[model samples]
Target: LGNQAKAAMNAGDLVSDDLIMGIMAERLKEDDCKAGYLLDGFPRTIPQAEALKVMLAEMGETLDCAVEIDVARDVILDRLTTRRTCSGCGEIYNVKSNPPAVEGKCDKCGEPVVQRDDETEEAISNRLNVYNDQTAPLVGFYKNEGLLLS
Candidate 1:
């Protein structure tokens, strides 16, 4: 699921249920996951969680826990607002502390580093608002199932 999500994110697309489920199906067949596997950055929405539940049920498995990384909205906004990306290599950097070797330049490709329009405070705030409104319920959903750990 992490790989699928990373691929979708790198392709500038939203991670969908089909992609995540496909990844999970493939992973569950592997010997390493026969016992257990820890999930990170998955089940971002209720629908995705439900899809994962169905897949796990078919596999005779269930989630043991779900943990939330608690961070303040202001900190998230600060981080997002300071984020920059290499125009050529797509390497992300933080302007606040992790600036490139050459200011406003890509350390890997020496290309100019640019702030994405979506990384602006306004855009990030809007995205956070939507996430809180639409996806925050997953916390309660997991809690109700006694799977929420933090």
Candidate 2:
């Protein structure tokens, strides 16, 4: 999953569900996550959510809720397209909101800060399209399970 993630991101593609689920299963078994963990953007599809249910059941755990922070699509597009990251230190910046002191340079690491390939407008649009098609249904899936907070 680790190796495939970079290639997928570079291609503006989602990682295969099996790879993600496998990694997530292993991760949830770690000591730190044994207590609990916040999965920011996960279980994007109904199938993944179902897999999570089975996985958690096997672990004697259950998800409390799924929180959806709804933002306007245009706002999401603008935010992602303007996002930048430091090549060295991975500091985040935004062209509109939070820019580095030196243009195109990381304020902390003095390394080049540039837009990620996956953050390009076209790439983001593609991602949003995929999300709309494949991930949006999870809203209804979680809602039906009484675990959704939108």
Candidate 3:
């Protein structure tokens, strides 16, 4: 599900709710997700969160909890700035922290790796602004539902 969102993000664009929902619905219906699944990088918007509730209700399932890792924003900036992306496969690597086994090449796909413009400081600042505006509210939203764990 995150693949589509990642493709959108890699191009410096915010993924639309429709694209996110489509992929999420497909994954959630799969057999592997029946027992349990750990979801990350989802419900980035209030609409997505609301729609997820409706979908889960239809499936007779509910989120057990929403775990938030409360990291400082500056730390995120420092870490994300070093990220590089694979052109063939959208795998991410942090040059200084988790470099690929082969420098400038994807370890999994053998593709040329390059830094995404989206991870530039200015671009990351823009994304952070959007996160603050549209996504931060989710923390309180889930907290009110008694499903938030930090």
Against the hidden true structure, what lDDT does model 2 obtain?
Answer: 0.90
Q: Can you write out model 3's per-residue Cα lDDT over 24-110, one digit (the tens) per residue?
A: 898889999988998887888899999999889988999999987777889889988889999999998999999999999999999
Cα TM-score of candidate 2 = 0.86
Clashing pairs in 2: none
In order of appearance, the predictions have TM-scores of 0.78, 0.86, 0.76
In angstroms, the error of model 1 at 123 is: 2.4
Q: Which candidate is the best by lDDT?
A: 2
Candidate 1 local lDDT, 80-140, one digit each (tens): 8999999999999998879898899898999999999999998999998988987788999
Instruction: Give the distance in Å from residue 134's predicted Cα in candidate 3 to where it truly belongs.
Output: 1.0
Candidate 1 versus truth, CA RMSD in Å, comes to 3.6
Best by TM-score: 2
Off by over 4 Å in 3: 1-14, 86-95, 98-113
Query: What tens digits encode model 2's per-residue C-alpha lDDT throughout 91-117?
Result: 999988999998999999999999998
